[model samples]
Target: MVPIPLASEPLRIGLLGCGQIAQAHAAALRFLADDGVARVSAVADPDPEGIRRVAGIVGDLERSYSDGRELIDDPTVDAVAVVAPTRFHRDLIAAVASAGKPLFTEKPLAPDFSTVCEIADTVRAAGIPAQVGFQSRFHPIVRQLQDWVVEGELGAPMAYTIRDDQFWPTGAVVPGHSSWRAERSQAGGGALLEHSIHSCDIACWLFGPVARVFASTRHVFGFDVEDVAAITIEHHSGVVGNLVTVFNGVRDREERRIEVFFERAAVEATTDFIIGAPEDSLLLKQDGAPAERFDVDALRRATFAADGFDPNREVFVYQYFGYAAFASALRRGLDPVPGIADAVRAHEVVEAAYQSARTKGAANVADLRSR
Candidate 1:
């Protein structure tokens, strides 16, 4: 593996893809650059236009390559971020791991569970620090919900309901950048994998590992992949929840809401996945007490402070926080949270849900993991 970078040295990050998501990482890296945490030193993408777009955001990159492998092999790149398509993740991850560079990859590690396992094994064998993009985990309201669950501040957890709806990527929402998301071979699955995989991860993070799942799906957009999926999950902790994910025709609107019910309390949170959370984003009620509202900005500042970051200097977007955390972990020579192992666990639940949909019965998550 590459020598662990000291905390004082800024990590030189090489980005493997310069698509839409890559732009977000570039912007985040730009923010981190001011703090001497990291900088976008190199970028690779087949599209010259994409490369140009990201270079504009990061400003003065050391190098840009048309081939991702060249960027991976570049001596000056201290780490690599894989923002490629889901179908390309396996090979890119293997290349980055083999290069002995730390990796930060976007979510749903791969389209299939077995390939996700293969990627995890490759990263483990290489002894590289790796993190997957489950960015919502970095949101302060979500962190507060986790604390409430873990500290038993809300008695025993009972159930949860999470609904995530977005305008279909292949539709007018994202334009030219999102066509691959509609293809089954490229995206692996439909709404379940490309989108709600975050919901699966969040469900497991908030409650515990999923025990079993029963699911049903629909092809509202008539793509080869299902655009709508409804899943019922039973957590190992005895918490049960229903998740509904849809890729619809809603223009300029992306909605996400998470409501968890406890034995004595209830918690609800709402936010735009593209933008950040709105004011009064969190609501809590315990027993006979009135519901309490929380300012999401204040909660976010407190969360950043607890993590030893200056809230005023940090970007408020949830995606930026994940990249920041990854950069911090790289500086400290430590593995980041929501790592590949965590991705595998979340994928296991998703794969089980798919299996249940196929067989029209509950599928055991442990059974999928055993193989």
Candidate 2:
């Protein structure tokens, strides 16, 4: 088995956006920098305030620009992070590809299917390392669940269910809310793309490539896009799954969970990358036994037992592993986990879901596989 690569020397990371997600990425980079992982060399955002805000957190930014093109073109930058809004992802990705820099982009690849494929094609042709911000995949619980399932501890693959019902960002207030995410032309879709895309990617990662997608979405909150969606999927591994993403729920709590049922056993995981959540547990159950629960703390202890585990470690430390993983992949000249191909495939699934919502029928994932 190949060992996971670890970053060495200096990795100068260039951030392409300073929006909300950029703040999180910058925070992660700060943690990674302590371990000699990477440093934020420069940043770019259209808004002057965006750059100022992120610079406040990242600190020591060598250069700042309002246009992402100028940042990508800078010779001092080693890698790029496309944390801009989805609408700008395609062009930024193309620019980074043209510059031959490894990239890490926030999810949904783009606002539409064709552009997502186009960006992925460009990145693939560039032959540079890339990773997407499917941060949940880096969660230790998720990794353990996937490993156990693949090792047959979950028995033969049967079926799975994914749900990401969040409260905020319902888009009921459109122009009053985060405008880019509320508009169909800007966001592509609502709940499915924004909230459940993570679960969608996880489903395919744990199961197999998606074969077909059937979905129905509604503008429950009168947003320019759908606020609620129910998507059914068929996997090429002969497994079937359903994904439910309802962003308009009138509730105070957020729920993100996925359950995979196998022939003789089952595993269920909840929430996401953010560490130290109350419900962030992974449970497993066999045919006639009781369910076993696993959480971030337990996983951390077990993983570092030989290294003298420290239970009081900062939760943000675990979060930085994803950034380190991306740097390591680039350093080792390996394909990053949840890379461009994965993003493109997940984007295709979401696109097919939109098509299914329109035709009221199952749509083949292959239909949008190219453009």
Candidate 3:
């Protein structure tokens, strides 16, 4: 495997794509700049306005390119973040891997499972460190849930339900603005792939690998993609769960609420879909006991106690914890969490769901994984 150079200087990150998500990463880089961890040194976007807006957030970037490949070729860029549309991931990941740069890509890694596999293979062949943006994995409530699972506090898993909803990303939602997400060719799939891929990842993380899935989908917004999907998943460990993902017309309404039940306890957590803050809450109720609520800040402090950074001072929105963790891993020359393998597994589950939707029966996740 290629080794990341141990450097005292801040890691220079080249950002690809300057859309809404790119802007969030820019803001995160700005936050991490205070600790000398990383900074946005360059940005690439076909849209000048996007580049300009991201530059405004990051401030005084060393370089900007209309083509992402140019940014990948720039020697000064220590690492690269590919925030471009799903359709463009395959080519950009190939380019980044060829250049031997550590890469951070937003999910879904590609529009389809086969392409995601191709990109993963490219990265593996190049032996470069890679991370995929399942930022929810870094959410404080999610961390606590993971801890609960590991500590057996939740007892034997019984069932779960995750509802992920977001304001539809179309011109209708934001007047005069067009979203690539409205196109199936660009976004791969709607609701399920574009949004609740995070939910799929979180489910697998908290439970176990999904064994099979049965799904149904709807195109309520009349887009080429499905704006709603309801999937039932059976895990390898015998836990069963339901996930509902929707891209609705609700203005500025983005939310995810998860409720998981076990033999000994039940846990429920709620947070904003795109940006989770310290004030988000999680509640736990053991058998014959009252529900106890915990704010995200308390969980964050408890989870990251050894990191030496105070959760109160840092901005928790824009997935700051995820980026901070990425920067720290790069600086330490360690592999990042929620890596490409995690992304591939999530995509496999999503693909299986889509297949089950089409076949009108349960689809085996292992059937896709075997390929």
TM-score of each: 0.95, 0.91, 0.95
CA lDDT of every candidate: 0.85, 0.78, 0.85
Over all chains combined, what TM-score does candidate 2 have?
A: 0.91
Between candidates 2 and 3, the TM-score winner? 3
Cα lDDT tens digits for candidate 2, 149-196: 679865778888888876656334433345678788998888888877
Instruction: Residues 1-371, candidate 3: write the lDDT tens digits.
Output: 33478433577889999988887899888877776777889999999999999999998788999999999998889889999888989999999999988899999999888998998899889888888889888776777778888888669878999999988877656875567888888888999998899999999998888899999999997998899999999999999999999999888788889898988999999877443453377999998888898766666676555456655655645456677777778767788888988888899889999999999999998899677
Error of 3 at 220 (Å): 1.0
The global Cα lDDT (0 to 1) of model 1 is 0.85
Model 1 weakest 10-residue run by lDDT: 271-280
Query: What does the lDDT read for residue 365 in candidate 3?
Result: 87
Residue 239 CA displacement from its true place in model 3, Å:
1.3
**Runs in model 1 lying further than 4 Å from the true structure:** 1-3, 6-8, 171-174, 314-316
lDDT of candidate 1 over 1-371, digit per residue (tens): 34485423578889999988898889888877877778899999999999999999998888999999999999888889999888999999999998888899998798888898899999999999998989878777778888998999779889999999888887434657567787778788988888888988888888889899999999977788888999999999899999999988877767789998998998988866643444238899889999998877787778878977786654745666787788777766678888988898889888998899999999998798677
